[model samples]
Target: MASQVPPQIFSRRRRIAGLRRARVRQAKRDAARYILDDMVEDVLDRLEFIRMSPTRVLVIGDWTGTLALSLRGGGSDVTEHDVATLDEEHPVESESYDLIVSLCSLDRVNDLPGALLHLRNALAEGGMMIASFLGAGSLVNLRRAMLAAEPDRPAARMHPLVDNQAASALMQRALFKRQVVDSRTLTASFGSLDRLVSDLRDQGLGSALANPPPALDKAAKARAGAAFLDTASDQGRVLEIFEILTLTGWKN
Candidate 1:
């Protein structure tokens, strides 16, 4: 007979699945507002080193396929791969792309390093990659609130967010040359706590926690609302942090 896994492990997996489903649902609902346009400008701003015109490009996790469309607008042949379901170990192809851009989507991937390697392989020797992803500094206030609400919980109520240092390390280890990494924190304010939560739902953020706290029951929801309201500023705005890191490297 196979050994039974601990209940906690099973619970954690279930929570992760629930979070993924919630994110997919949100993606379906808010695809237009949350996709390409939101991150493409930032990606382009950081891709200053790349020549304006490239022959072929590949985009991993083409959420809303905005990047692909943008590259096409710039007159490059573009191909897209949605890595969420495909075998991450084998992305698309090797040495085929002049540029590969990943935007705000790699944090949810299970094998981040492997994905990076696959991306590198997909690039020609001189090809460049410009990637932006959410960093660990994101959701500090929310994380603190959750921790305070459940001080004894072993795991975080949100997914494991990465920091700049960790992201840099991942990039450096990916065997790329001319590596440059930078991070920035964006603060978006909400008129009310409920709107903040709803915005997160709309953006498909924070939907991959291990053993996430159960959905807010009536009393729990009341408490959470009170807590966020207490933290509101005099201007009646509550802030949420989005820590984004941009990494650039070239295949040697």
Candidate 2:
């Protein structure tokens, strides 16, 4: 049996729809390409030093299909699953895969521990699992803008992120061997507040909170825009920081 997803944390439908839309836009736009590309590249580059090349691979959250294609191109047999299709109890045979990779989706999972356990169960002995997602300290400027819009009483809008330490703990709890968690920050610049929000949407960074804050009314939206603009650099561009956490482990 799988653990129950906590309703207080995320909305599955919204998260799914956001990724689906992102998949579509990614074919035509470059705005959201770097993050996913960078993650896959990092994993592959590290695999070189480890002296391992997984032959049977499972890739989750290949919304733009880049990661899966990259693996297949490198001669690995690949199985792909969009993250939205995976539930807490999604079946995977024990010792089924030599490698598993998930990018940018685990953060939105309502039953993260359960998901990690399943991934571990699917890995063959000595097999590796590597996953990455948005982490704590991300989006400082955007968070500030939202709060400024409703200074008196801010609502729950952004999804909370798991920091590096917590991520390591989760891997240990899931019984993955050689657990490791680390983070890196990537900075994205935008010409305007609205453009920043649009880029987020394009990248499937929509709110996954189960009870999302009410839509910003015109007045509030205007205020947020004004506040966001005030923080622009001398070049008249706003920068948003994305802290990406990576978790890695091997099945014993």
Candidate 3:
């Protein structure tokens, strides 16, 4: 006789789904410090072209708040919002900003194009938006490992990744003028798979596997652990990839 579907599987599925939603939400609020701090600082350093004395500025996402804090410290008027809070019915006031900065948060948005348009609408003519986010190429190794572990599993509901070309194309379609887009992959290493997974949780990257495979029994967990261990290098290190896309454009 065929074995019954394990109750644990359903439980795991529900847990994973909840985790995914939580992570997506967390990504908006918690703002990973190491990533946000570095990326925001870099964007600020490159803001020489943008007028320094803008009377009103909008910062979207937490990293944007970090940028706003810096700009305010330098004496710029700054207000902030979480992108998730913005929508058609409750739009940001029209033409309210001289500058808008969004950092490392757009990819989690359900409507990237719409958000760009809203950002454009919120800006005064000649205002600029500088945004950075993790694109399609992020997290290749973890994705591969997950697939390797469960080749028959169903596809993910949320986007687990984004690529550079796709991100650039989306920005182009948004009609921002003379858009500047650049992307680069940053690799972080972990001493073991467990630590790697832990770091992902800490960074709010665990949300992608919204419906991870059901919890394996002790034997299965051991087997998967062995498989990963076998694939590890002599130093027992595993690599996680973060592909960051940076873009700047003006609302003409």
Best by lDDT: 2
| Per-candidate local distance difference test | 0.66, 0.82, 0.62
* 73-111 per-residue lDDT for model 1 (tens digits): 878898775544444445654577888887656676666
Any residue pairs clashing in model 3, and if so which?
135-162, 136-162, 136-163, 137-162
Candidate 3 ranges with C-alpha deviation above 4 Å: 1-32, 49-53, 63-65, 87-90, 157-160, 208-231
Q: Residue 103 in model 2: shift from native, Å?
A: 0.5
Compared with the true structure, model 3 gives a TM-score of 0.74
Count of clashing residue pairs in every prediction: 1, 0, 4
lDDT of 2 by residue, 75-118 (tens): 89988877566653355654579999988888887778878998
- lDDT per residue, candidate 3, 108-208, as tens digits? 55456666777777788878888877777776665555544545663442354456667667677877887888877778776655666555554544543
* TM-score to native of every candidate shown: 0.79, 0.92, 0.74
> TM-score: which candidate is best?
2
